[model samples]
Target: MVFKTPLLDKPAPGWKQDLPGPNESPSIEPYPPVLSNPPNHVDNVYLELARATVRTRGVGVWLTFLMFSLAIVALLSLIAYILKEGTMPPPIPGIALLMGFIAALWGGVFIWRMDVDPPRDEPIRFNRFRRKVYVYRFHHHGLRPFSRTAWGVRAEVYDWDNLRAEACSVYGPMGSGGLIETVTLAVVKPGTHQVIDRFHFAHEIQQGEMYWAMAQLFMQQGPQALPAFPRPPRDWNNEDVSFNLARRLAPKVQWPAEIDLESRTAS
Candidate 1:
């Protein structure tokens, strides 16, 4: 005997109303294409320097102050201890005071150097048609304590073809340490192999990939080749193809024998 099981006739609660039916098409608007800055007349790839956060600067200042305070307190305590003990050694009389003085001097010098060599915000631009890289740096000028009363911008240009070699060095605690990796890209002089410029990228691996792609594009493309920014492949970071390409192109860079060294040096 054949028997048919009874089917439930009730509709699932709100299922038909909430979701599109098999024959119905959902009403969805397609996302608009993201618009980027139109390629310049000569197609340039521009990169801006990363800026430090106010919190980061605040922490740095606090750390510096703490270090200075600790140094001062230690020096004062040592002086007081020596005075109370009334101990004098023939080999090094007033040794504690001498050490404290040296420590204070070292700390003062460190703080002075840090203040003089403050971090700069610089942006770099690469021109494919002109085969030049431009770096823009801003300078501040003022009198006495008011050091930042006025500002000026300076531009430095370097030849793309003169880039003899390029290298990316990765350093940081890998594995389980959880420290972020730091990458440095250095451009070297062709024959001398001396580093002319170095670019540092922190945490962001995509920036390093983009730079390596640019280097490869510069090497392989002809002078008249249309200027285009190299797009990173899907597996750019996974396989480290950018790093490999940079290594391969480094040895192939060559400068014309007749090129004037002085003019190159000036740039």
Candidate 2:
């Protein structure tokens, strides 16, 4: 038997090729959107605010030192003037000088401590759910999680939770000359008293997206009251691509909600 070729076996016809319209571009599908740069004025203002916040911390430190130094100089001058006058500087005046000395000493201690003290501790609780495979780090690492970068900070996702990877923002510097970025997911239930990873401060991946994702995730499960985290302006928008992706990927079984009431109260 002779072997036949598939394409050559088709019937031949008088062919008229249809072409694209004169002005129409080739029909490639449009690409999905990534995050857009915030509008000019809005972004400028936000950057300005962020820059100001970083600078303000430094300014506060210097201000405290200056005040303490001024207090010491004033106290010494008062003592010298009182001794020179040789009249005990009056009962009322001497008492005022004494008060000034006390204030100076206290102020100096406060200033020194502010610079040397450990970062203010916020109540944090840690838990491991779903074996070593799933661990969650949440709540009150104080300035560690929110105030600093979040690149490599330990984050948690329920095994059953869905992650909408594209919609999240990953921030900060990654190792070996690579930039750091974060992708976050939606959790069915919230956990509590999580110890924050301090080592990840400068390497944050989800500095901006976490607040928005958390808010929407909380809203999706019925209308019961939930504890509020700080609201960022971006949280106002509805239904991001990530939310849709997460809905598709989310685990079929919901995780039980866990509470940490004993560790601390919202300040």
Candidate 3:
């Protein structure tokens, strides 16, 4: 028997022509969180924000630690009882000790995992004076004594001039019967439009303002001039808009060319 590949549908010759031109504008509609009522947090000074996931994870870590601590305490009590009660079997103490050890080991592993796999949605800090952006992730262990150093915090820095920003809309079905819209901010490499970081804001009151505030800082453009959500040329894909904006706004950096075969041979 011979195997054959299935044919795929092909676009018409005029498909490109049929698409809306760059100049054409779609029915741009403005959604909630009006420009007038920007979030109070949108100030000219340094800005710090964290994704919702990070907050949720922090709560989860504390809860896990509490549960583990209780288990450890109960195991220790069991071991003590086994030792004092002469009526109990000889192996009771040993079994309790073994279980306690296992619980302790589990607790250690949990702390290690939390430290190494810190939440992805860490806080983002933008310092205007320093011209830098910093993202911070925190790790904590309940067993260890509390100390600032023991927080296991880590930070990553990005230069202000090298950063690019993009906004995209996400839609999903809501249980209430209507669709819910979410806005996402993407920090990207200038010119190339490669995404380095991203975060989301629920598309509700005040969130839009927060997005614009950050975008203004990243673009180094005035807040008024920053691109608004549901950007123009609605026919274009969000990815296309992001790339085009990056190319237009970012300074074009000329990368060094690859060495030729002749140069390699001579070397």
Candidate 4:
């Protein structure tokens, strides 16, 4: 099934759904607790803000990119050859062509989705200094099917106290027998369990929890309390063709000025 989640102010699902359990801020103790060591955090995105700026590209992006790109080319080629022969599509080839076209359409959509110019990362910044989190997101229209929802870029700010972490898992498309799990920071209404807003945090749970822990530690005790990132950050600034093409065609990380400033300040 395709993955879908309520966006900005859409009422969140009630707790009774079969979805994964709500991973509260530190699962009855989330690993790498507020007092624990950082679990090899690496986000050139930004550890610099008493902040955690994270990427929107989740798991399976690269793999989906490859699969869909190939499907578009191969499927289109098959359609062309069949058309060139001027014969009606046979039973197997006909269904195959239909499936291929759909897959190709989605593949093209994936390419359009990711390959973008700078600032497309939709970076979510958690500023411990200001006790706030600023989300840079492109809110798509949820009324349509999930894949079609790429609407507009907007920045949102929230008080840090109301945010809760939740894990959502969805099956891979075309029955690929794979599971994709992600962590999202849900914004609950002040003093209530009602979630009002949310944004993607980490592609995987453990890493996201670690980032969450580090950010929490920074907010409460300052940056000195957390361990250093395992290595220099890795970002799209390098010369790799994929990176360069992404910069040329689509996504990169650049936070809004107001949020950026407040997130980094001590006062």
Candidate 5:
């Protein structure tokens, strides 16, 4: 004999639902997309420099205070011990104390300048490799008091493709300026994300898939060949891509090369 299970009726439209327990997890929504400026941020030095400006401010202050305090304490202790233990006469103890004070003061001042109110904030640009990372910076205000202020960092590996950048207004007590930041790309092949090398591209690769992640194609095979037939130039049609941006600049980026983005896009 076969045993049949009884059919259960569906719950009413407005019936109160019973939850499994407090141990159950609640549903979560996906994170929002991050907006960025400067699409090619993977190797831009200027973007990293801006980040350093904010980071260094806090570190510099703390280091300056600590070094200065240590210098004062060490100098005073040295002078007191020398006067108490050494053969120096009681009448000339003030000279020993003065010497110790000077030494301590000098060290404190030197550390203060090096740690707080650093000299410059320069521009930089660089490339980041798969196995290794690279960084570059420009000399800011060449010979001024605050010159050559720059810093850089790199990780073992980053996704070169699918990289994005964004621009925003940087605000400080003084005023505001344009600021840009970059996000490194990542991928999980095995259990975790790992860095790879150039040699991995030894097989068949297509135009779209080959180097979309890379900042610029090296073109090892030389320049690509175009069709033999020449095409006539188009009539005055579309507006220039940088027109709006250029008009606002006091001194625009006037490069000698033709700004033929439209033609490049079409081809």
Candidate 6:
């Protein structure tokens, strides 16, 4: 049975030629066991329940916040010192005031750009037995203070068979790393190539293919056929002290009870 996506009904456009092109992927489904790298960014995998889940990759939100936080604190402290002292130290008083004002403005911009109330991670669940996939997507406009649009989670379910893989190449900042890429799984309309909705799958191109292959293998032959993951299944609650601290600030994963129950159990 094909489960309908809750997000959209229209065909997802913007895939014109020369933009995220190469129409189809060679690593599409019925993928063989030739893939290497077992799985990456996976938070949990249940062999018994035939379920595996992974979060969005490369989101080092904690580090980013830390860097910005320290800078903001320093800038504020400097501004406070200037205000308290009421004396000019380096350049002219006007120049010092101007510099302090600029620093304050930069600090405010940093706060605006920082992801303050982010959902810990965007988790995507694959239920092999049910031949279904669930995405816990957190939608936000920008940081809370600057953004007028409220942020929230948008969960969706899809039939595993209707999904197709699209390898999207991304250029690095200053075009540093040549051929940097990721995999985006497009949900086609039942039997047609028309895309209805999509979600990111993996980070690296080769590893993404391997990860998709692992998903295919698990969905087809169960977890027994899959190789062991390099790292053990992550326990979010008992993660590293630093990550746990970061998690405290981010919103918890609140999957719908019905979807959560259905995804983890064979009905």
TM-score of each: 0.42, 0.29, 0.35, 0.58, 0.25, 0.58
What stretches of model 2 exceed 4 Å from their correct place? 1-56, 120-267
List model 1 lDDT by residue over 96-214, tens digit each.
Answer: 55576666545544443233323323334454444555544334432322333344344556765543222223344657545333333334465443566644422233333333333
Using TM-score as the measure, what is the rank order of every candidate, best first?
4, 6, 1, 3, 2, 5
RMSD in angstroms, all models?
21.5, 24.4, 16.8, 7.9, 20.2, 8.3
Give lDDT for model 2.
Answer: 0.29
Residue-level lDDT of model 3, residues 170-232, one tens digit each, is 344546455343433444566544556654432432453344344444335323433343322
**RMSD in angstroms, candidate 5?**
20.2
Candidate 5 TM-score over all chains jointly: 0.25
* True-structure lDDT of candidate 6: 0.53
Tell me the tens digit of each residue's lDDT in model 6 across 77-168.
65776798885345665465556555555554433333435455556767766778777765554334345356657778888877876555
95-208 in candidate 2: lDDT tens per residue?
787787767656655443333232211111211121111222322232232233321222233322222112212333646555433322222222321222211111122332
- Return model 4's CA RMSD, one decimal: 7.9
User: What TM-score, to 2 decimals, does candidate 2 have?
Assistant: 0.29
C-alpha RMSD in Å of predicted model 1 compared with the true structure: 21.5
The best candidate by lDDT is 6
Model 6: how large is the Cα RMSD against the reference? 8.3
Candidate 3 residue-wise lDDT at 57: 28
lDDT scores for all predictions? 0.36, 0.29, 0.40, 0.52, 0.27, 0.53
Question: Candidate 1, overall lDDT?
Answer: 0.36
For candidate 2, give the lDDT of residue 76: 79
Report the lDDT tens digits of candidate 4 across residue range 120-167: 345555566566766766554323313443555667888878776655
